[model samples]
Target chain A: MVANIRDKAAIVGVANTAFSKDSGVSELSLAVQAIKGACDDAGIHPREIDGFATFTLDTNDEIEVARALGCGDLTFWGRSHYGGGAATGSLHQAVMAVATGMAECVAVFRALNGRSGHRYSQGVSGELLTADAIHWGWYTPYGLLTPASWTAMITQRWMHRTGVTKEAMFEVARCTREYAVSNPNAFFHGQPLDRDTYFNARMIADPLQLFDCCQESDGGSAIIVTTPQRARDLKQPVVTVKGVAQASAQGQEQMTSFYRDEISDVSEHRIAAGDCYEMSGLRPSDIDAAVIYDAFTPNVLLQLEAWDFCKFGEAGDFVLDGNLRPDGRLPTNTHGGQLSEAYIHGVNGLVEATRLVRGQSVNQPGKQVDHALVTSGVGIPTGGAILGKLD
Target chain B: MTPEEQKAFEDRIYAYVGVKVCERTAAKDAVNPAMIRHWAEAMGDTNPAYTDETWAANSRRGKTIAPPAMMYAWNQEGFTVTRGRASDPQTDMVELFNEYGFTGVLGTNVTQEYFKEVSPGDTLYLEMEIDSISERKATARGIGYFFETLATFSDQNGEKVGTQRFRVLKFIPQEQPTAATGDDKLEVPTRIPSPRGHDNGWWWQAVDEGKLLIQRCKRCQVLRHPPRPMCGECQSLEWDSIESGMEGEVISYTCLRHPAIPGYPKDPVCAVIKLAEGTNLVANIVGCDYDDVFIGMKLKGRIEQVDEKTTLPQFYPA
Candidate 1:
């Protein structure tokens, strides 16, 4: 069982570099910039940081980022895997480190040149040498090469079983784009999406159009985790880490897990949600806002079901009923999510979730956000975290 | 034709149902390793039980056993398939269809179930009957009538070993469309090759020789795919292999359309196939239209040399 660490750690600062298609800088420079910005927000010098956590896919190394930031020797350093699936899992590592007194301050960061460098949308190309390449080899020869294609395999089956159509998928895209229209940091800002344009967009994979996919941006995001007592003296209002969890179910794969008994279900999300809720003593009804990963529009709907916000097969109706709007029931992705916002993998969603808990969102919901839920990517070993105002 | 004439034609075809296409015919040769090996190679199956004498002697089965899917090989007529065959109901029905101008024939479906295992020296006999005939229906190919045949096999001791059902469509050929005259001819791109590595090199080598081998733990008998060195179920370093039957159903599928990658069609139907041997692999659904693929659609796979350097398993509707 996961040890209860509710309110034990706090995120005192959250910062992100300008989201862009091209950064014109190295990933190490982005990392240093984001980390310096986060430390500045917390009213601390970069040299004060003593620990670090990040995703394994991050090109920037820990010692290099620490050296560039002039940080002291790191005591607690950790990294998680599966790309965006480990976005919050990296934070979970920091929370554990701070709560257990292993480190005084831990900075979790993700920096990438996803666009101008190695674009994931280009699909699998060149030779793959990793062990993960073995299973990927099974599909690449069949022309199932892209992340969108892997996701569509499950989305297609989900639609078949639930009788949902592209209309519901469009609602998810439209709702997130609505938030992006007002969020100045979002890549889709000021670019409103109409149903005509969405329907006219070329298909990336069956059931997934170009608009449904997330923007591959070159950007960086950082968060500072420390003891709740130490966070009370920070520059920003303390936002408590009420709960955090990472889980992988049986037969889990990196987005290609089709062998499970229910191919459409996100079992890892279910396990992680169960642990997160139990740890925080919160339920789906307690969450006022959510930053569910939206690498693709269909993921929002599937995650809505997996998180138990609504029962399975009802997310189509949930989104179509306008429940994601500011005055609506859930008010999801207020920062536009990865779909409309720049995709920093998923760490950008974490920054938005932190903003929601701090009551500083540009498109904050009308209701008070006492607790906000944020999740990493699905279709792999994934995780979720809950943030709330310090008691 | 008028409704009455259509009904008359359907009735005449339906009359052949329950007609014996073949009486009990003995196999020309007994089950042996040479034929088993040849069958395994053709089907791309590399189950050690079929050919590895030493491994089979030490394994649980204790001796060599033919793959259960090879039951039909024993009864084949080989080079003289047309000469030694007698006039049967199946031929008469085909002749009748040909006379009516429903001349194009296509094998659409086949399913086999095994009961008793057949090993070396087992002589098999076969009996077949026309199972059913459907009314003429329009299909993507043309207007066609479907007929099913069922065959049962038994060992020399007269115990049942297996049974097979085969379905074929006889149709009138559709008018061929004119070939494209555009100068923008689509160049066929070689498929992305499977990444052969230290762990999975043997599996790809088997595919080169037309075989699909599944890594199996020698101790716990657990099966692992993509050829890993360690079995997840049991922490065993010792392992062997079993050849897949290459029979499966589409558990899930997708059609990729955007950013048209090289080495593929405009839209290719890719599927996750749950093999009959209780494992799954991703492969292309070929030999059929993309729209025809569905969850739970039965399929049969073949290891084909798709490009200059790529040999992969491609599936067809079964």
Candidate 2:
């Protein structure tokens, strides 16, 4: 059935632009820059890249990015829906294309001037578009406009179910910022965030403080993928795609599944995480480092629990106990995560996982990261990957 | 930065918690059709409920109503007076921050929770209180203190309409107010109830008359909270509304802690109710701490006259 395409493909190269609030360039330029950089890093001619993959949020289309990269006509072009939930989906498509002999070289990229172009935190200026707008029409009058508002609804229940206090989320901000202060690439570089400061940062949404949410950074990231046999001759170490999966629960609504029995459930990520584990034959204990998505502070906790890294309703304590630290149980988001690094739609976390698999991460855990679990954006339809050293 | 010094400092800042800052300040203008039109023009909103009288009359709202997003417009101190009096909690808090070299102030975020609709002639009165004050901290901007204020808006009859949670950072910025991340004069939207040609216009009409009406199916004698045209059990089209004591129990709930909702901060959507008769409805749990609310708790529904267009059901511990 080809249910598990284990070790069929490997990530040969990855590149990320400096994360920032304003890039002062078009999203198209960002995509081209990242794609070209990845191709160069992979030592692959632009023409060798025939497939294009990315999420729905990016402004640039596959045809435009492919054309811009001078990567002749594309044979495979696909995108995943649900904003950041499709972070690993681009890689999943790349893997499927290469494994099935549909395409030789696939370039997975995500580029968006989130801050300069579509500042999500400031709220939208125009009329609501998209068919989802009609569904949102039912809740907008209640003030559920921004993504944070939708998350706030779920977070409320998650808190009630888990007994996880708002205080526990602050630790995520502080820890990620602590790592970010050390990395020059982080928006909070040189800006240390202590627990008290994190607490003092005003609440944007209930349970979610200002720092609890991720920075709306403008950035682009790309990963190069090909058949594991072909990747043997690539420029960088082969970070074999051990497993990849995407999933959605029965009652999944982008972020608002308010009518469900368990409103606190992030079952989509759990379902995706299960697929990754089943396909890779790697348990949670087999993972050395993880790059859990941190679009919001609580998202990390939810992903940690959803992926079975910690018990359900116990991620808050796992995080508070310093488990996600560089020296802790599992060094997570060593690139400072979307919370501190950048929100490139969770692609940056995948880049970090690739780096970990290559043993080239800037903040490499004291113990080398042989296997890393890279999760996409949580709290919605989600996807994930288990990246490991090419054995 | 010393712990002892920080302790003393925090102790002093903590003294202002829960203090009533602003005496009831009336909105400069009562909700009126002209004000609604002005808001619609500013927003380029073409919603018939906000502008067209004929369309709104035929719609579920029965008449033009103010947008929930514009809930704060009525209470805005805009270009007029009451821009934080000297003794007001807001002014005092700012002054307190200034004394600590945190002379600059910028809004971090704001959250509103809307419960009901507001329309013409609804005079809004706002009461402000110091929700919380954080310990001093250093940032890229400079040293700062974040203080949050909760403002409750009600009408002349003291029926709460909404609440607003405003969090502001009083900082000595390194530069001018961190160049607003692309704030190109876009007014945040005010939400109004989506009144499509809903089949239950009579129910809303009854609410306007200060009555809590539940639709009853004549064929099978079953009551429904949301008035649907046909009964699910009997497939009956004939139905009538009957007034009940408006009592229920807390079944499930969510606390909506959003920065800014269209209306005022009704904070924590509170609870979903399983009514005394039958059927479920969502409403806020008031008159008690939100954290204290639990499933199976006895609750009684209190309908508040939010405006000429809306009467909202709010639940309190029975």
Candidate 3:
């Protein structure tokens, strides 16, 4: 079931720490600072916030956040799993809590020390030694253990099935960095990448160059959600929650979905996109702009195909044609995404969605953004949310 | 070292490559709740679902679920020396190289991947197989021998669960003189005793009685080594201690020229002996040279009483 928060709840405030390779602060401190900045941006007191939502991987506890912010009481607290997939889901939970009278005001936050702390790019190891960990035993024995290696398997299969070239994948990375160059807050801001640079980048996993993967950054971002009436009375114009949905396909494994019927097609994205579109009462053509999760460049194309934004295997051509550019139809990741911006588990994607609705984005698209779609992590049980201007 | 010794060393080196020993128990049902809780605490996951049963009932997945990463938390149980006793190194390769005398070994990289969900109540059957063995010329860490081993785990129904590929590097001691391999002869004793017993103040009393015993479920007739309370096959609590013949045939064997485990003698010969009663046991094959321990070799079990409290089961050619 989908809960429509259109004109009922809105994101009135948003704030984030500086995105960088290393932010010399604890994750908790970053979270608290982001929360305080968001609250201040909305001109609301901390005592008014009654709900909190964040990622399960986030180190900041709800109670601790409340204590740090001097919040009076919390009526709703929630956490979403599946890494970057929970970015929009956290907002969805906050919006639901505010709309249903579960909480008067809800705050959604994500704090991560991605680079200097635990780097997922280092590959999956330690604490993964159980019976289930043995499944990768077959693949790792042949030297395929990293996340890029896992995704490379699917990318290779996708390439073999479709005549998509490495040039097509590079185009996606190029477009993302292009947007990043214009985003002042982006870690790679002012730095643009080209096809040659993308191809020449170090090979992290086979077929996946270093630039194809997202940059690990230490940062925190927070968004405040309140009822439309309350949001209208606050500092910013009410940006309605059009629709949100989370989906997990059958035969799903955590990171390795190799046993699925089709590895190239992300079934979770297809299912989530269907639900998000149906709930929003909109189609792919209706989305003026989007923030497609870019944990990996290939996943961006996969999301486009799965959501029917482009036909199957047609995303390579669509992306190459500058369809995802700010001037093109359906501008995506206007804030550089996880690839160019600091990846805070897709939280910054949601922030970009809010910016698109508020018309405050650095890489603002030409057309009026009536609807902005945002997606969560791609490989696992992903999530999606749509934001629209209040009627 | 004579030419025969060098030939024996080469033979041992070849046999150690891609060798594996299987643990009889299944993966799914072998989960220990206490162990899962401990790992969850270590990971700093305070989700009540892993601890509180009431909270778990309301969880999205319904039942209490172990954290996704908790499935890889099984302590490595090494090869069994006797019916109920096993041998494991006191320290890991990294720890031994870091603190102890093996100084040359450095630049260690470990990579692991996950395949399936290791839920609670799943019995885990583990099989450790040596994937490859390669020797590199003297690096900064003396002469290094790289051994890659893959451990495959399966559930009770024999469904493949996960796999672990471990790369171990053993640095040769600088002062240790290169020993002749062929001169190392396998020693076998005449009489073998059964290593088994119930906890009656002393755990391994049956080994002193000169009989090998295994706990058998009377209802299902399932014989279980490393005895537990109930029969994993039928979940029958009614069990009787049964004595089996010490003689068995080797299903697979490996002669180790490099010490994978620290403090153990270098080039020790290990074999997975399939007992006549249809159970496989892993132990050192004694009383035969490294060249003689081949697949399907017949061997008889002998009890080597280590001290007043412990007895090790050693096997030799029958």
Best by DockQ: 1
TM-score each candidate.
0.72, 0.68, 0.58
Is candidate 1 or 2 superior in TM-score?
A: 1
The collision pairs in model 1 are B44-B210, B44-B211, B44-B212, B47-B243
Question: Candidate 2 chain B, which ten residues in sequence have the lowest lDDT sum?
Answer: B185-194
lDDT of 3 by residue, B5-98 (tens): 6466546555656544444554333675676788778988888877666777787756566664554456444344245543322123334334
Off by over 4 Å in 2: A122-126, B1-189, B192-258, B261-318
DockQ, structure candidate 1: 0.45
lDDT of each: 0.87, 0.77, 0.72
State the lDDT of candidate 1 residue by residue for B1-318, as single tens digits: 687977887788888999999899899998888988988899898889889989999998777888887787778789897676667889999988888789988776566878898788888999999997766666656798878899999999999999998878888977744563346442233677777778888998998999988889999998877667888888999999999989999888888987655445457789988998888888888888877889899999999987766888889999
Higher-DockQ candidate of 1 and 3: 1
Model 2, position A43, has a per-residue lDDT of: 93
DockQ for every prediction shown: 0.45, 0.17, 0.02
**TM-score of B-chain for each predicted structure, in order:** 0.56, 0.54, 0.41
The TM-score leader among the candidates is 1
Stretches off by above 4 angstroms in model 3 are A1-3, A129-143, B1-318
Across A257-347, the per-residue lDDT of candidate 3 in tens digits comes to 6544355688988888888888878898999999999888988888889888998888889888989888988899999888998888888
